[model samples]
Target: MRLIEKVWFRGHPAKWLLVPLLLPLTLLFYFISALRRALFTVGLKKSVTLTAPVIVVGNIGIGGNGKTPMVIYLVELTRQLGFKPGVISRGYGGNAPHYPYLLKEDTSANIAGDEPVLIHQRCQVPVAVGSNRIASAQLLIEQGCNVIISDDGLQHYRLARALELIVVDAKRLFGNGFLLPAGPLREGRWRLNKSDLVIFNGSPNTELWPRKLTTPNAIMQLTAKVVCNIKTGERITLSTFVQNNPQVNAIAGIGDPQRFFDTLSAQQLCLNNTQSFVDHHAFCLDDFSHFNDNIPLLMTEKDAVKCYGFSQAHWWYLPVDTRFSAIEQQKITELLITKLAV
Candidate 1:
C-alpha cells in the first residue's frame, strides 16, 4: 500500500506501469465529476437549502486532511459565539441500523464511524450520521441547533452550503495531481479557489502553499492535549507521559499514521516499535497480542474510541486538538463570523 501510495505522492517506477493502466479510469472519473457539478450548476439537480446556516468542511482529495479536527474546532468556536452548532457526517465505514442516527451515550464507533463518535464524545454536541446529508442535518436542526457543520461533503452539491472550508494535508498536497486511480484526488486543484477558506494541516505557515490555491487560507497545527488511560479513565498531561523516556509502542489507523508517530517522536518518547493500520481499521483484542504488557501502548484518540471496549490496562490514547497561530486564528475567526453572518 505504501509503495502504491508513493506512486501518487512521490516519484515511483511503479507510476510508469500504473499510470498507463490508470489513466483511462482517471479520465472517466474526471468526466463523471465534471458532469456531476455541471448538473448542479445548471439547476438540473436540486440542492436542499436548510433553515440553519450550513458550513461544509472537506478536502479535494481522499484520506484525512484534518477535517474532523476542523469540525471539532468550529463546534467549540461557534459555541463561544453563542451559536448552537450541530454536526452531520456521511459515516463512511459505519452501518447504522437507521438513517440520520443521532449519537447517544451507548453509540459505538462501529455504528457512528470513528470520527463522529469521537466528535460527539469530545465536544458533547448533537451529531447525526447518515448517507443523506440533508436528512442528517435536519436532525441536528430539530435538536435546536442554529448552525450545521458537515464533516466532509464539499462534493455533495445536493446540499446547499452557506460556507465552505477545505482542509489540505500540507505535506501531501494533491498527490500526483490526478483524480482517482492515477493519483490520490477526488477533484482537481481548481476547486480550492471556490472554497471560502483552505486549511493546511501539519502546517502553520500559510506562505508555503502554491499559487493555485488562491482562496483565503490558514495553517492548522494538531497539538497533543491529554493522555488518558483507556481502561482506567485516568488522565494526565501529554508532557507528563513522556517524562524520563517512557517505553511506548505507537499504533495508528489513520490516514497518515506516520504523522502520529512523528508527533510522538517529537515528544521524546522512546518507542519500542510502531504499527500502522489501514485508516479506520476495526480494533479487536487480538490485534495487540504481540505487545509486551510491561510497555505502554499509545494510540490516537480516533483509535481510542474503537479500542475502549476491550482495551488493556497498559493501553493509553492521546487526544489532539487543532490550533493556529494568534494572527491566523483571528483571521479564521473573523472569516467565519463574516461568512456565517451572511
Candidate 2:
C-alpha cells in the first residue's frame, strides 16, 4: 500500500510520522475548497447552469466506490423514462486528441479514459470527456442530449447541477474522516447532507453513517454472473467458466481491488493467484508479460476497456450490473422524475 493510503486507511506508526507533514497541506486544501464553494455560493464567482439539467453522480472520498456503475445505472434509468441522457466526466488519466471529445464506438479508452468508455459501451449513450465540464456538457447539448449525468464532479462548483447523488464505499466510510491529503475525502462528511440522495455501495453497516443529517439514502449492490473473453466476444456463465477453468488468475486495477477479488471468490471462482494495481492504471501489454499465459486471466470490465486491443485468448473480464431493490429503484425513479421533471 502507498504511504498516503496507509496514513488515510490504516492505523500504522508510519502514519504518525507522515500525518503531521500532510496536515498542513490538508488544511490548505480544505480552506481552498471551502473558499471556492463559498465564492460560487455567494455569486462572487460565476457557475454555469446548463440548458439541460445535470444530475451529478459522485462521491466524497477519492478512489472508485462504484461511481461509474451508478452512472451507468442512471443512464439506463433515464432512457427508460424517455429522456436522452448524456454523460460528462473529468476523464482523469486520459488526454484526448482534442477538448470536448465525444466518444464514438471506435473511441479508445486510452483517449477518453476507461470509465467513460465503459459507460458508453454499456449504455450506448453519448459521453463527453474533458477537464472543462461546461464545454463537455455543452457538446452533449449540441448532440441533442436533454439531460446530463456527470460522472464524478461533485466538487466542481462551476457546473451547476439539478440533483446530486453520492456513492459511498460502505466498507471504508471516509478513512480518517479528514479532507484530501490527510484522508480520502475530496469533500467532508457534511457534504453528504447537501446531496439529493446518498447511495451506499455494498452492504451498509448503518452505524457508520454520520449521525443526524437526513439526506435520504439507499443501497446499491453489484451482481456479476457472466464472464466474457476479451479477444473474442464469447460469453459464458461465471459458474460454467469456473467449472471449466479452476486455475484462474484474478487481476484488478480499481479503487478496491480486494472487493473485486472477493466478489469473484464469493461467486465460486477458485483463484490460483491475484494481483492488484492502482486505480485507473493505463494498462499496456508489457504489464502482463511477466504473467503465465497458460493460466486463465480474469479482470473487471473496467480494465477490459483498455485491454481490448492486445487481449490474449486466455484473458476474460467479468461485467457487473447495479442491483437495487424494488423500493429503492422506485424511489430513484420518482426522484429523477420529480427532480428533473422529465
Candidate 3:
C-alpha cells in the first residue's frame, strides 16, 4: 500500500510525519480552492444554468465515496418518477480526442471512462463526458434529457445545480480534517453544510465528521448479488459461485479496495488472495499474466470494464447495487419533487 493511502485510510501514526512538509502546500491548495469558490459566488466566474434540474452527487474528499452507485440509484428513482434523466461526468482517465463525447452502448471504457460507460450500461440512460461539465450537460440536454445527473460535481460550481447530494465514506470521512496533502479533504468539512442532503456511503462513524455534518440524511449500503464472467457475460449467485470456485484471487482498482473486500467477506466469498491498484489504473494484458487459469480471478464491476477485451473466462466481476431504507428513499424522492417541482 502507498504511504499516502496509509495516512488517508489506515490511520498510520508514523505516516503522518509528512504533515509538516505538506502543510504549506495544503495551505496553498486551500487558498486557491477558496478563491475559486469566491469568484463563482461574486459573479466573477459565471455559472451555466441548464433548463433541466441538475442534481449533483459528489463528495467533499478526493476519492470515490460511492458516487457512481448513487448516480445510478438517482437515475432509477428519477425514471420511476416519470423523468428522463441523463448523466454527465468529468471522464477521469479517459483520453477521448473530442470534447463533450456522448457515450454509446459500444463506447470503449478507455474513451468514455469506466464509470460513465458503466453508468450508461447499467442505467440505460444517456451519458456524456468531458472535462467541462457544462459542455457535457449541454450535450445531454441536446439529446432530450429532461433532468441532468452530474456524476461528481459538488465543487464544480460552473454548472448551477438544483440539488446537491454529498456522499462521504463513513469510515474514512475526511481523514485528519485537513486539506489536500496534509489530509484527504478536497475542501473543508464545513462544505457539507452547503449540500442539500449529506449521505454516508456506509454506516456512519460519528468520530470522523464534525458534530453537525455527522447527521446524514440517509445511509447507503452496497449489496453484492451475483458474480458475472466479464468475457462471457454469465452470472451466478455468490453461493453458486463459491460452489465452483471456492478460493479465488480477488483484485480491485477502486478508491476503496478494502471496502470491496469487506463487502465480499460479508457475502461469504472465500478470497484466497487479493490485490489493489490505484483508482482508474489502466490495465493491460500483462497485468494478469501471473494468474493461472485454474484460479478464478474476482473483481468489481468498475474494474471489469477495462479488462473485458483481453480477460479470460476465469475472470469474474461481482456486480453490486446500492441499497437504502424505503423511508430514506421516500424522503429523497419527496425532496427531489419539491425542489424540481416535477
Candidate 4:
C-alpha cells in the first residue's frame, strides 16, 4: 500500500496521528475550492450547457464507490426509456495525445483510461475522455447521443448538469468528514444537499450517512458470480470453482481492494493468497514472474483490461453487476422523465 493511503485508511488513533499536521492544509484547500465554486455560481466563470440534458454520476469523496457500475446501469436504464446515452470521463490516468479521445473496445487503458474503456466494453455506448469535459460531451452529442452521462464530474463546475447523482461508499461514508489532506471528502458535507439523488454502493448505515442529505436515496448491491479466463474467454461459476476446490490466488488493483476480497470470501471461494496494487497500477509480466503457472489467478474485471496481451490461460477475472429494486428502478425512470420534460 502507498504510505499516504495507509495513513488515510488506517482508522482510529493511528489515522488521527496525521490530522494535526494535515488540518491547516485542508483548510486552505477548502477555501480555494469554495472560491472556485463561487466564481462559477456568480457567472464570473461560465458553465457550458449542452443541447441535451446531462446527468453527472459522481462522488463527494475521493475513492471509487461503484460509480462506473452505476454509470453503466444508467446507460442501460436511459436506453430502456428510449434515450441514446453517451459517457464522458476525465480520463485521469490516461496519457492520450490530445483531448476528446473517443474510446474503442481495443483502446489501451494506457491511452484512454481504465474506467472509460471498461464502460465502452460493457455498456456498448459512445464514450469519450478529456480534461475538458465540455469538449468530450460535444463529441458525444455529435455522435447522436440525446443524453450525456458525465461519469465523475461533480467537481467540474464548468459543465452544467441537469441532475447531479452522488454515489457513496456505504462502509466509509465520507471518512471522518474532513476535506482534502485531513479527510477523504472533496467537498463539504453540506454539498450533499445540492445533489438530486444519493445512492449507497452497499448497505446504508444511517448512523454513518451525512445528516445534511435530504435528497431521495437508494441502495445498490454489486454481485460477482462468474469468473472468465482472460486469454480464451471461458467462464466458470463460483459454484464450479468451489466444487473443484483448487488453490486460487486473488489479485485486485482497485480503489478498495478489500471489498473485492470480501466478496470472494462471501461466495465460499478459498483464497490461498491475495495481492493488491495501487489503483490503476500498470501491469507487466515481471509482476507475475514469481507465481506458479498451474495455480489459478483471480482478478477483478477492471484489472483484467490492463493485463490482456500478457495474460496467462490460468488467469481469470470476475465481472460485477449492480442490482436495484424494482421500485427504485421505476422511481429513477420517472425522475429522469420528469427532469427531461422540463
lDDT of 2: 0.90
lDDT of 2 by residue, 49-88 (tens): 9999999998999977899989999999999999999999
Candidate 4: give the clashing pairs. none
Which ranges in model 2 have alpha carbons more than 4 Å from their true place?
none
Scored by Cα lDDT, where does model 4 land? 0.86
Candidate 3 lDDT, 71-92, residue by residue in tens: 9999999998899999999998
lDDT of 1 by residue, 230-261 (tens): 99999988888888337899899998888889
lDDT of 4 at 219: 90
lDDT of 4 by residue, 1-342 (tens): 665566666565656578888999999999999999999988999999899899999998886689999999999988988999999998877988888999876788899888888899888899999989999999999999999999999999999999888998887677677888888889977777789888988887767643656888889999777779999989888689767755788888898898888988888778888888888888898988777787888888888888897999889888999898999888888888888773
Order of candidate numbers by TM-score, starting with the best: 2, 3, 1, 4
RMSD per prediction, one decimal?
A: 1.7, 1.2, 1.5, 1.6
- Report the C-alpha displacement of residue 256, candidate 3, in angstroms: 1.0
TM-score, prediction 2: 0.97
Q: What is the C-alpha local distance difference test score of each model? A: 0.89, 0.90, 0.87, 0.86
RMSD versus native structure for model 1: 1.7
Query: What are the clash counts of all predictions, listed in order?
Result: 0, 0, 0, 0
3 or 4, greater by lDDT: 3
TM-score of each: 0.96, 0.97, 0.96, 0.96
- What lDDT would candidate 3 get against the real structure? 0.87
